[model samples]
Target: MTGPETDNESPETDDEPPEHRRYARYLELLESVQEADEAGLVAAVLRDDCVAMAESAVNRHLERRAAQLLTDAHFPDWARTTAAVIGDRAFLSRRLREWTLLRAIALDEPWTAEEVTGASDWFQRTAAAAQAVSSPEALDLLAEHGRTRRVRNAATLRLRPPRRRPG
Candidate 1:
């Protein structure tokens, strides 16, 4: 049975580029996040759609919004915690780092090498690897010393190859 199409349900036309379609949907998701009540916000954050955005300006904005949504005290603890737990599953199971999940745990704050060392939880430690490119040393520390296998694995995956020493 066909239902009336709403703005959010607009069908993609043949001419639309995939990237444009994805970005359009990403914008809609952002608007939904803003309008959603606490429960709705949590649900949106944990949705596969939110996790599926490609790395781009749209995804970066989503990460920022999702991070804020997860940490906002106005939301109920169970709601925030539920999203974080689910996001963690997504982060850990995926072959690559899920920036949205990573940013959420880090509260969208920058993680210094020292802060990564001081992180109190696995998520913090894992997200700390976002700095791996900038600070391979920090990831080296985690790869060797992280308390958990998952943290160690996450760090190891992001580490840069050791430089060759000139003979």
Candidate 2:
């Protein structure tokens, strides 16, 4: 009998559409979570893996929520894959941690200090924008500007050029 490892070929090649494929996987997970069977645990594990793969696909682009939904799914296997894909590591960039925090809240996952480290300067300012609001109206005004989304602390600051152009 061939063992599980016998197959030399890898699964989920680059050609697959991970986004579309994940729905079927999540359906299986939903059933298993409802049934609480050993199969369900297996389904969840597989679903998490699928979510991770899907996130990596989304991560290659500048997309936010699409990638985050994979994380917001809240499986460790999934969330671990949802972070900003920087060199050799992944995370919510300093410019984007608030979105991650808000997402964590929406998902009922609390933000951890470890995840909050290396926060971008933009994150602090955006947090303050929300914090500076004292009344509902102010928040509403900001919200009108799509400010409900995480505001950048300072990713836009620019330096002035010198007046002289040497000839």
Candidates' TM-scores?
0.32, 0.25
List candidate 2 segments past 4 Å from native.
Answer: 1-62, 65-76, 82-87, 90-100, 112-118, 122-167
Question: Relative to the true structure, how large is the alpha-carbon lDDT of every model?
Answer: 0.48, 0.37
Give the per-residue lDDT digits (tens) of candidate 1, residues 53-89.
4334233444555455444654345334445444555
Best by lDDT: 1
Cα lDDT of model 2 by residue, 1-167, tens digit: 11222223337634555444454444334333432243333333333445454334333332333343534444343333433233232432322345555345335455544333334434333433533222333223233333224432121121123378789
Question: Best TM-score goes to which candidate?
Answer: 1
For all predictions, the C-alpha RMSD in Å is 9.9, 13.6
Provide the lDDT at 154 for model 1. Answer: 77
lDDT of 2 at 77: 38
